[model samples]
Target chain A: MDQFTLNLIVVGATFALYFGIAIWARAGSTAEFYAAGGGVHPIANGMATGADWMSAASFISMAGIIAFGGYDTSAYLMGWTGGYVLLAMLLAPYLRKFGKFTVPEFVGDRFYSGTARVIAVICLLIISITYVIGQMSGVGVAFSRFLEVSNDTGLYIGAAVVFAYAVLGGMKGITYTQVAQYVVLIIAYTIPAIFISLNLTGNPIPGLGLFSNDTASGVPLLTTLNGMLADLGFASYTEQHDTTLNMFLFTMSLMIGTAGLPHVIVRFFTVPKVADARSSAGWALVFIALLYLTAPAVGAMARINLINTMYPNGVKETPVARADVPDWVANWEKTGLLKFDDKNGDGLINYTSSAETNELDVNKDIIVLANPEIAQLPSWVIALVAAGGLAAALSTAAGLLMAISSAVSHDLIKGQLNPGISEKGELLAARVSMAVAIGVATWLGLNPPGFAAQTVALAFGLAASSIFPVLMMGIFSKRINSKGAISGMLVGLIFTVVYIFLHKGWFFIASTASYSDSAPMLFGIKSTAIGSIGALLNFAVAFIVSNATEDTPAEVQELVESIRIPKGAGAATGH
Target chain B: MADKSSSNAYWKANIRAIQIFLVIWFVCSFGFGILLRPMLAGIKIGGTDLGFWFAQQGSILVFLVIIFAYAAKMNKLDREHGVEE
Candidate 1:
């Protein structure tokens, strides 16, 4: 079968599986809808959370980023996964003990202020919306590439499929579907990686193969790759180009940001026991690390393979004839993801990037999504990759939509708008909220405020500064009263957003954004590294504000201590 | 009552253990990978400096080990604390 047909079959079957699970596992009660009835097995919840957390960035963009950015891109790998450690150690267990349905619920109850709740809700909405935009666009990209539809048309189909499961199944249904999605994505991701690894290094395990010697030339694969990339004027695949300070701070920001993200944090609430929350986080990281470990391998190997295909004999050799170019080049060229221009009117495909030498400019996002075709792998593998990308996007989108819907229905309409609401009425409200969330996400996916997916990093930065701080203070420090929490969040939220907007538009940093990261970062801090500093500012302001305010009530003080000690912690469900 | 006291002691000890492990985490990732990277810059690994490995793969692998070890040890701690469910 051709790549398109194979992708259609694989992606079609994956969606059919998710939709079927949604039908079979439709949530019956608000509790089930919201928390998966608080009884998910620890390992199962871990897998689902892994699926939710990875998203389009992890599945599609990461390998591509590393392939091109070389070792400097390790910031992404370490920063993202290292954050899981912080999550498991610092935040997850405590939040699970709080036993709330939503991150905002914990915020409201712990701070004893509706203002704190509202701030958290705003942060959650911003994070979820920005995050979802990427997922929807990813869905669209995958569909357009594999299913022969336009990007917008692909988004509409993706939105429809997402609505089918998210509205009907709620968290309960979403959890199981996400777990299934995780399996599909990992299988799809690892299969091509294994093949490429064996072909390159004669090592079956891509993770180990990255460090091992190249069987063909008896040199370390990374060593060979770095030399070749440098010869072409690109940074070596293993060489560090970023300043140490920036790398450290960037990784720290991602770690704190990951720990603070409300969507990932809320997953712990679904498990039955405090221990389960702890163990679940560990399991989630294990699953996530499976791909994270292999990403560098794939990135390095793909860079090598791409250079080889372009040069044919070796990177030092003359370029290959376009008309006689390999079949893989033609396949990806049709998708417009892979391309070569004979800038000097030479029939050969030039693969260098210096001012003097002609070069082919490849989109960084295509390195992973277009990998199988680029390597001339089997059509089935190409199809599997398409399905995997969709799974990554859909699973994350479902989670984000659930967060948005529950915030509106459970927190806004049910909790505050009408506490006297009947169960039947609330269920309807949840469905309505879910529908609205998906609609808004889909619309934004089309005419994005900017680079739809890139806004995702800003969402993390905002979460790092605003919501995470308030949640930590509320649960861990009773002295941090409602007044302190609210003020601190306001300050953090304002400063972080302003910093990003000045660089990005007030909304997003499209290709047209005035201030690039290369532009003067505040105090020499890269935009990506700004969140950790914002977090510090948040902590400082909270402490100062709390000290200025009156003492906490005796009962609230006791509540904080109890949560701290993890005594009387209740079982939570993953919906 | 004695068992509860013993369990509390176990939990305290486990916290101390986690603290020690976290220090190592910082030293490898934050220290060798960043602040002290210059100190290790002269020492190379596979053509790149020693600091680079810690920044990328070494720190992350260590982090994974720390978490998994903590989970297993913490489970034991919980069992000894009489808190395991």
Candidate 2:
């Protein structure tokens, strides 16, 4: 069968599986809807969190980012994975012990303020909504490339698919579906890596294959990669290009942001026990590491493969004629993601990072999606990749949609505005909020703020600056009053948003920024890395404000004490 | 009975464990991976420097070990303090 037909079949099969799980595990109560009745096994929850956490950016674009950025991109790997250490040890168990349905509930009850709850709900919405936009656009890109649909139609379809399952299943449905997604995505990701690895290095394991000798070049993969990069006037693959300070802060921000993201944190609540929450984080990291470990290898190998394909006779030889450019380049050219210009009128491709001599301007997003095709892998593997991309985008979109809707319904409406609302009423509100959130996200996806990975990084920045510090202080410091927590969140959120807007454009409007990351940075910190500074400011503001205000009530201190001990942890079903 | 003083001790012990693990986490990802990467450049692992390996793979491996260790150790601590759920 044709490749498109095969892709449809595989992607369709996965969707059918998700919908089936959604139907089977339809949520019956608020407990089931919010926390999957807290009955999920540690391993199962781990797998689900893996799928939930590894969003479209991780699956579709991360390797591509690493491929181009080289060692500078390691921040993403270390930052994201290391955050789970923070989660497992610092946050997850205590939050699970708090035994609430939503993150805002914990924030509000712990702070003993309705205003804090509302603020927490707003912050959750912002983070989740910003996050889901990336997922929606990711689905759009995957569909536009694979299924041959327009970006708009693809986004709508993705939103609809997520709405059907997420609204029907809630956390219970999302939990099982995410587990299935993890399996499908991991298989899809690793298979292509394995094939390419074997073809390039004669090693089956991509991670091991990365360090092994390149059979084609008769040298270490990294050595060959650096040599080729030098020949093309690009930075060496092993060398760091980004400023050390920016890299440090960016990595730190991403780490804290990963811990702060509401969707990932909410997944811990689905487990059966506080102990389960701890172990589940470990298991989740194990599952995540399978992909994270493979990513660097995939990035390094794909970079080498692309260069090899371009310079078939080696970097010293004349470049391939523009007419002889591969079919993958031709296909990507139609999408405007791959542009070739014979600047010197040589009619030959001289691919270089230098603007003057550069022939190919390749969008980083295309590297992973087109890697299989570029490597001449079989049609089935290509189809499975399409399925995997959809699984990653859809599963993350579902998770974020759940978080957004719950914050609106459970935290805002039920917890604040209409405390007397019945469970059925709240569930209806949840579904309504999901539909609305998906609609907003779909519209934004149609006009995406930036590349999937870059857009997601902005969401990470917001989470890092705002949510993480407040949550940490709430659990760890009994002295922090509601005023302090609220002030900290506001300061962090405003500072991060303004800093990002200054560089990325005012609310992502193009060409609005006066200064770039290249020079005139705030303390030599790029906007992407500024979130760490904001987080520190948050901590400072909170402490200063807390000390000036009235001390915490004795009862609230007791509540903090109870959470820390983790004894007499109540059921997730309990209010 | 879970007295206030005993619970306080348990919390302090847990804090100590957290502090220790966080130090390792910081050293692996930030220290080895970024700031001190230049210092570790001489040490080679596989095809790359120690810093690159740590940044890409080693830090993640260490994170896994930390989480599991914290969980197991804390669970044991909980039992010892009669705070086990």
Candidate 3:
């Protein structure tokens, strides 16, 4: 069969499975809709969280970034995975024990102020919306490439499919579907990796294969790669190029942001017990690591393969003829992502950093998607990768939409605006909110600001600066007053957003950015690394305000004490 | 009164475990993976140095172990303090 037909069959089958699970696990009540009836097993919840956490960026873009950026991108790997440690240790168990429905609800109740909750709702919406836009565009790109449709049409189909499952199942339906997605995505990611690993290193395991000697060269893969890159005037693969300070700050921002993301935080609320919440984070990381550990190996090996294919006679020798460029380059050229220009009219492809002589410009996003094709892998493997990318995009989109809907229906409307709203009314509101959110996300996805992974990083930075500090203070420090929390959140949110807008353009208009991501750093920190500094400012401001004004109320102090002790953590229950 | 003291003790034990694990967490990712990476440059693993391994693979593996360790140890403490749910 043709590659397109095989992709359609595999992708169509996966969508059918998701829809079937959605109908079977359809949520019936407010409890079911908001928290999956709070009955999910620890392991099952962990699997779902894994799907929620690993978005399209992880599946499609991360390896590509690592492939080109070399050691500098290790910050992403460490930053993302290291975050669950902070979450499991500091946040998950305590939040689960609080036994509330949404994050804003905890903030409102813990601080004894409705205003605090409203601010939290605003933060949740901002972060979740920004995060969802990336997923939406990811869905569009996956569909466009695999199904041979326009990007906009692919986006609409992706949005409609997500709407069906998310609206029907709520958290309940989404959870089970996410578990299935985790399985599909992990298999899709690992299979091609194993094949490519064996081809390059004679080892079946990709993770170990990364360290093994290359079969063709009989030298360590990294040693060969570093030598080849240096010969071509590129940086060494094994060395760090980013400033250490920037790497530390960027990694810290991602860690805090991961812990603070509302979608992932809400998943813990579904587990049966606080202990389960703790264990669930561990299991989730284990599942996530299955992909992460393989990513570097996949990236390094893919780079080697591409380099070898391009320079069959080696880089020090003559350049390959333009007419001889492979099908993969031609396939990507149509999308304008991969460009080749014979500047000297020599009709040969020369890839180098030098602007005057460079002949090919490869978009970083294309590397992972084109890897299987570059290696001459079978059609089924390519088809599976398409299905996996869609699964990653859709699962994360569903999780983000769930967070947005719950924040609207449960936190905003029911909690503050209409305290007398009926349970049935709230459930209806949640579904309607989800539909509207998907619509807006799809519209914005048609013209995304940056690549899927870069836009997703902005969401993390926003979360790191705003939501994380407030949530951490609410649980860890009893002395922090509502006034302090509010001030800290506003300051952090505003400062971080302004910094990003200045560099990323006001609302990402591209023409408006005064500075690029590199150079003119704030104290030698890039915009991405500024989130950690914003978090620090938040903590400092919150503490200064709390000490200068009033301490936490007496009853609130007792609430803090109760959350600290985990004795009475009943099995998960809806509010 | 006795029950109150025991619960307080349990909370303290929980906090202590978190503290210990967090220290380990920082050491693995931020320490060995980033700051102390240059120091470990002398120790080669496979094709790269020890620091590169920590950054990509070692830290994540350690993070997994830390969480499970915290969970198991905390549950044991909970049972010991008569606070298990």
iRMSD per model? Answer: 2.9, 1.2, 1.6
Pairs with steric clashes in candidate 2:
none
Give fnat, all candidates: 0.37, 0.80, 0.79
Candidate 3 clashing pairs, residues 3+ apart or interchain: none
Q: Which candidate number would show the highest DockQ if scored against the true structure?
A: 2
All candidates: CA RMSD (Å): 2.6, 1.6, 1.6
Q: Encode model 3's per-residue lDDT on B1-85: one tens digit a residue.
A: 1277897788788889989999999999999999999999999988899999999899999999999999999889978988767
Instruction: Please give the CA lDDT of all the candidate structures.
Output: 0.81, 0.88, 0.88
Q: TM-score of candidate 3 restricted to chain B?
A: 0.94
Model with the higher TM-score, candidate 1 or 2: 2
Q: Sort candidate 3 into its docking category.
A: medium
Q: Compared with the true structure, what per-residue lDDT tens digits does model 1 show for residues A1-575?
A: 56667777788898899889989989887877888878899999999999999999999989988888877787888888887777776778777877768888878877888878888898999889989988888888888878999999999999999899889988889899999999999988998999899998889999878877888788888788888877777766665677767777787888888888877887888888777887888889888888988888888888888888787788788878888877766766787777676778888877776756664768778888767876668888888888888889999999999999989997888767888898778888999999999999999999876556556768888888887677767765768987888888888888887777767766663554567777645655677777777887888898898899898888887666555444466655322
lDDT of each residue in A1-575, candidate 3, tens digit only: 99999999999999999989988999999888888988999999999999999998899888988998888899999999999998998999899888888999989988888999999898889788888888888888888898999999999889888888899999999999999999999999998899899999999999999999989889998898998898888888889888999999999999999999999999999988888989999999999999999999989998888788678799898878888878887898988888988899988888776899888887877777887888788999899989999999899999999999999999888888887888889889999999999888888898775644455557888789888898889888999999898889888888888888777778777798888787634766888888898899889998999889998888998888777767687655545
Give per-model TM-scores.
0.94, 0.97, 0.97
Worst 10 residues of 1 chain B by lDDT: B1-10
